[model samples]
Target: METDKKDKLIIALIIGIVIVLSHNFVSSQKSDDLVFENISSSLDDKKQTKLINNNDNKEKNEKATIKKIHISGEINKPGVYEINDDYRLEDLVNDAGGLTENADLNKINLALKLEDQMRIIIPNVNDKDNNENNMTSQLISPINQNDNKKVDINTADKSELMTLPNIGEKRADAIVEYRQKNKFNKIEDIKNVSGIGDKYFDAMKDMIVVN
Candidate 1:
């Protein structure tokens, strides 16, 4: 009877150990499953964040590529407009409700590429004096009949300023704005304007004079 009790006790101890090991194995498997799930979730979140950032950057670049231009004179609707960088003068004219009946298309270069902060003036066929004042109109034909005569920096309009070599609309506008606040005492003083450095001044120094 004693031998039977010992065998039964041994069997019971073995059964208890097997049950504990089985429970431990199940807990460890559950822990591993949770770690894998967390890793997958983290990877998914990172991918989503990267995608969103790329989209935002794309949108910002598109906005940066847009150019702002101002159009006035002899147009149905003359105002500042936002246009694509690739837009031409004709495109901007159409955007401003097209040119009026009095607009002289011959004086304007419709194929000219538009630039940021550019001002466009459509000339009127009947207004000869006003057409002379129009920068765009003057650009098509030289206002100064004699090339030998130097341009007066102090009295020169935007179109006259643009007559200088390497001087575009932007630089011409800058020169006009600078002159409004301060007068050029001498021809060298033209360099004081922004974007008109030594090289640019050298190119047009002979063509400009201050009275």
Candidate 2:
């Protein structure tokens, strides 16, 4: 009878040890699962943050590349505008509230790409004949008495600069070089050129403009 009791006691002790080990194993598994879930969640949050940052950076880069342009003449709104560098003349015109009913679209190149500090002039249909005559006369004489168009000193090329009175190739080249670094703020600013002075500027003051 004592032997039987001893065997029973031994069996009970063995069962109790097994139950404790099983409970410990299950708790360890649950802790491991929770740790895995937390690590996965942290990785997902990091990826989302990186994606958001990338989008913000892309937007900033696009804004940085924006170009400022000026549009005028025969338009609903004629003023300075900000646009993307890749935008064409048509896009700018559309943004400026489209052209007027009398706007001469045939004279403007809508496919021209926009540039920073660029100026665009939309012609009036009623002035077509006069504009053509002036263009023909410009080929013969740099300046025409009948033409009221003023040379834009800030945006004129070498040949256009030569149109000014007493401004030969050398002076034209100098004007172009000077304007490349220092844009003309006003008609009087042309006097800042190396060879241009009060006398030279006075001769072309009525014929030139800065925009």
Candidate 3:
């Protein structure tokens, strides 16, 4: 009888041990699965972050490659101007020394796109005596003209020559040089400048009088 009881107790203990081991095994497997899932999620987040950073770097590099622009002409102050790729004409004008006293705002379309090494020429005000020498210069045409005559570029001073449309210090100088070199044969001889085209000549034809 005692042997039977001992055998029964031994069987019960063995069954209890098997149940505990099975439960622990299942719990361990669940823990392993949870750990693996967490690792995968972390890796995915890191990859996304890397991709975003790479895109940002590419954008920055593209912006760095864009070149700046420079401009010069009859501005309040004329000089080399450094402008960003997206900069507008108005912005560039402000950068390269603002408009000069006689700068004709109408002559320049401020909305124009700026190009590299582009020369911007600001025209003198119409019917105005304004010039570089005077920023606050006012428009005042020669009130006293000889009867039935107008001003002559061949003999006009720096200030007087500017009264003609598109005539600036540079053009005025060219006129004087041409007059001295070849001597004025006729008023039409004033077209030797590098920039003076037929259109400009037509505009100034009436304003100029050969002395």
Candidate 4:
């Protein structure tokens, strides 16, 4: 009877050891899984942070390419404007709500590139008493008496060009197409159009202005 009791005790001790070892192995596996999850979350957070920084840099570069300029004199809305750096003087005039009625479009170089903090001055056509420096610097053209009354060939559309003597739809379209490719530098430059000649110009000399 003593031998049987010893055998039973040994078997119970072996079973208890096996149970303890299984519990330890399961706990170790769970701890490893938790560590892997934490590492993956940290990597994801780092990637998100990097993406946000890259976006911020791109926005800053875009803003840097914008130019700030001040436009005044004869403009409808003269003050400050923020625009693209490559914008021209003509674009500036349009941005300032277009030129005033008396603003001279002939003298200034409209294709000039806008720079940061630059001041753009648009002179009036009626400033007849401009100084020698103003004439030399701004290159203001003389205001002809017929300018206000005559049809401006430079700005007139095809319909307005057709109002002239001997000008039909085909002739008017040719004038616009020619002007688009080669701008008229003077009132006499209208003769360069397909249908216009010396005789035609003479008849309409009093009726046209380059302005």
Give the number of the best model, judged by TM-score.
1
Candidates' TM-scores? 0.58, 0.55, 0.39, 0.50
List model 3 lDDT by residue over 55-136, tens digit each: 9999999877664443334466655566666767788777766777766775566776665544344555652422444321
Scanning candidate 1 in windows of ten residues, the lowest lDDT window is 137-146
lDDT of each prediction vs. the true structure? 0.76, 0.74, 0.63, 0.71
**Reference-based TM-score, model 1:** 0.58
Residue range 1-211, candidate 2, lDDT tens digits: 9999999999999999999999999999999999999999999999999999999999999888877776666779978889975898889889999999998765667777766765455656664222342322221122345779889998988888877665666677888889889998989988888766664465578899999
RMSD of model 1, in Å? 10.6
Task: lDDT winner between 2 and 3, please give it.
Answer: 2
Name the 10 consecutive residues with the lowest summed lDDT in model 4.
134-143
**Highest lDDT scorer:** 1
* Model 4 lDDT per residue over 1-211, tens place: 9999999999999999999999999999999999999999999999999999999999999887776776666779988899885788778888899988887666467777766765565657764433333332332112233445678898998777765654556667888888888888898998888756664465466678886
Model 3 clash tally, residue pairs: 4
For candidate 1, write residues 1-211 as lDDT tens digits.
Answer: 9999999999999999999999999999999999999999999999999999999999999988877876766789978899986898889888999989998866778998877766565666764433233445333222232468898989988887877755667778888899999999999998898766564455467788899
| All-Cα superposition RMSD per candidate | 10.6, 10.9, 14.2, 14.4
Off by over 4 Å in 3: 1-27, 30-38, 45-49, 64-67, 74-87, 94-98, 116-211
Task: Give the C-alpha miss distance for residue 145 in model 1, angstroms.
Answer: 30
